[model samples]
Target chain A: MYDTNYHRASSVEEAVKLRSSQDEARYLSGGMTLIATMKQRLAAPSDLVDLRHVASMKGISVEGRKVRIGAGTTHAEVASSSALKSVCPAICHLAGMIGDPHVRHMGTIGGSVANNDPAADYPSAVLALNATVVTDRREIVADDYFQGMFDTALEEGELITAITFEAPEKAGYAKFPNPASRYALTGVFVAKGASGVRVAVTGAGSNGVFRATDIEIALSASWSSDFVASVAVDAGQLMEDMHATPEYRANLVKVMAKRAVAMAG
Target chain B: MAKVTLTVNGRTMSGECDDRTLLVHFIRDKLGLTGTHVGCDTTQCGACVVHMDGKSVKSCSILAVQAAGSSVTTIEGIASQGELHPVQAAFNQHHGLQCGFCTPGMVMTAVDMINRHGGQLDEVTVRHELEGNICRCTGYHNIVKAVLSANEEMHGASRQAAE
Candidate 1:
């Protein structure tokens, strides 16, 4: 909580300029995470360029197999969007499951993905559905976008305008959330498309959200709950905390994956 | 310092505060509306729940500057004139409060829930929707009954008005 300046950015380019020109500027979306961090003095930026006012970054559009969601669209909007629900109910369900109603009303998908928290819900969706992160600069595939927990391929001052992805044939998300905060303790998102199956695990990875290759391969071959349940996720690289052990998290990954498959079916 | 102007309980109020001032502080300290409590500033507790632009949000988690030009409603605004809102009346009838620390927030959250769900909420939906608002004293037994009764009251009132 330092003395900081707040600038309302009207457009994406203006937001970029506002952030890039400042000595230490942060882009503010929903401010669900950033504001909390700043309040805790964990982050002290000289300026915050508010992107919520930017009209271009607010919507959910679906066309054919393609679904493009504006980064600033709040989780509540996504959860309640009828157009998005018709095309991708799993996404709506995931959005609905994030935090509580108040948090969902304020938190945005763009903010969730940009922060790249290890336990965030959207990263698992983006990674599992093979979505693309569309920034003001360029498009980055979901696979290449996330690097590690709290890490992403986004360069400094870059603004994420929107995220685009082809709707999977079938997808479902399941998570064992931390009871107090409602953040994913261990979550699994499963998607089946023409390209086969993709499984992404979040909240358990020490390196952040990662693809469960074994689960993906098993589901690709069988596309059955039993197959996914039988697939073992390696606990070696998982994060161990007061909430769960590495081994327990690995088990959660498998169980969640199986549940996700069943739910998708 | 940041100068923010927001409509609180239908009053357009202006205030000056630090850029880091939370909306809860702005509403309570700056505007002098003490109904919104700050139980946990970490956003875990829903004690600071308020409606910003017709949507329920955690006032403690949002900055006053961020809420510039927005319309906010706190627990102080819940009662119209002197009459208690349907939810408030139901809370009283069902004995929904014990310590009353979380009442303001729970009432606000309940109003928002009824706003979205049309007051036809069942027990399961009420419990699920009440996930954000925690009541330590009531054991949630009376609180759930209050919400259901409030929903019924609201539904009957609306239905009667229509007729």
Candidate 2:
């Protein structure tokens, strides 16, 4: 690890200012990812702007059907929140299943969403929930937020403040996690909301998380496992890795979708 | 060097370290608390786990400066006065370790699991919760037993205190 300057930003405005002034600064949330990268000598920024203490960026709020979660909130906090459970238990369940208890305690949803790892759990949730990625600058809808694996639409100095979404009529998530790392092998999120039916697949996308539109259309007409089971997702569009082949991931997409719908029902 | 101040095991400790220094290194090299081990520095191994503001986290994955103003508890803090914490005592009684390399992290993680699960705990749940804390010695049979026993004893003591 190389020597760097550390700054604790008390406010979002101050955080932006700190980021702008530094020659090379990285925002620190929980340090679950960044610090590890630094220790591996993969990245060495000149400064670190700590955002863990900004009081305004922490909380879980559910008004009517809209759920707004602070960006700084930890996965463990989101997992255990009864307030969130009342409206969106799927999110709670999703957060609970991320990287075991220790990782959940240190990893933040904002960090996960920002990092946009192909195997991360939150991107599917955001895409499936039709959520808004609220940032210090402006709101980026889930559709426009994720650009690709390890990519997002967030501009330089843009900091995510919160994620807001409507509680779906029904939503369920299922993930086939890699045993060693606990990252998803192929995860599917299914939701039937007032807007329409949504199907977001993560951990199996060659281009990162993608919406399975065909699966959505089939489920929209009839919410049945038999129908979802019969749907053949294109294996070409899915990612192939050591844990799973493209055909295997394509199969997992279908299996996880059926399971998610069953759980949602 | 960056200035960081935080409470460690009830003592307000301050130190000057490189901004890249990990919290585990600060605890071990700077503060001279060698109990927290760093097995896999990439956060896969829970050997460096410690309570950051009352939540168990892999300390090696966290920078020392990130922990400024936060309270941290390590394995050395689990005992009260001269008496071992129930979890520690249970490990002794159950023969939960061999080389004892992963004991500190296992103990800290167990304390956290018991804290959250409360009285409603089972062996299966214990096994699931202990996934992050890997123990090569003893095959984890004794470690699992120790965690269950500790939960029982700790919960029993709390009940007696309440009564």
For model 2 chain A, where is the 10-residue window of minimal lDDT?
A: A31-40
Clashing pairs in 1: none
- Predicted candidate 1 versus true structure: per-residue lDDT over B37-146, tens digit per residue: 99989887799999999999999998899999999999888888799999999999999999999989899988999989875689999999889988788899999999
lDDT of 2 by residue, B32-148 (tens): 999999998888879999998999999988888889889999999989999999999999999999999999999999999999998789999999888888888789999999999
- Candidate 2 residue pairs in clash (backbone atoms < 3 Å): none
Local accuracy of candidate 1 as per-residue lDDT tens digits, A205-264? 999999999999899889888997777678899999999999999999988998899989
lDDT of 2 by residue, A84-138 (tens): 9988888898998898789989889889999899999999999999999999989
Question: Could you give the CAPRI-style class of model 1?
Answer: high
Q: Give the Cα-based TM-score of candidate 2 against the true structure.
A: 0.98
The lDDT per prediction is 0.92, 0.91
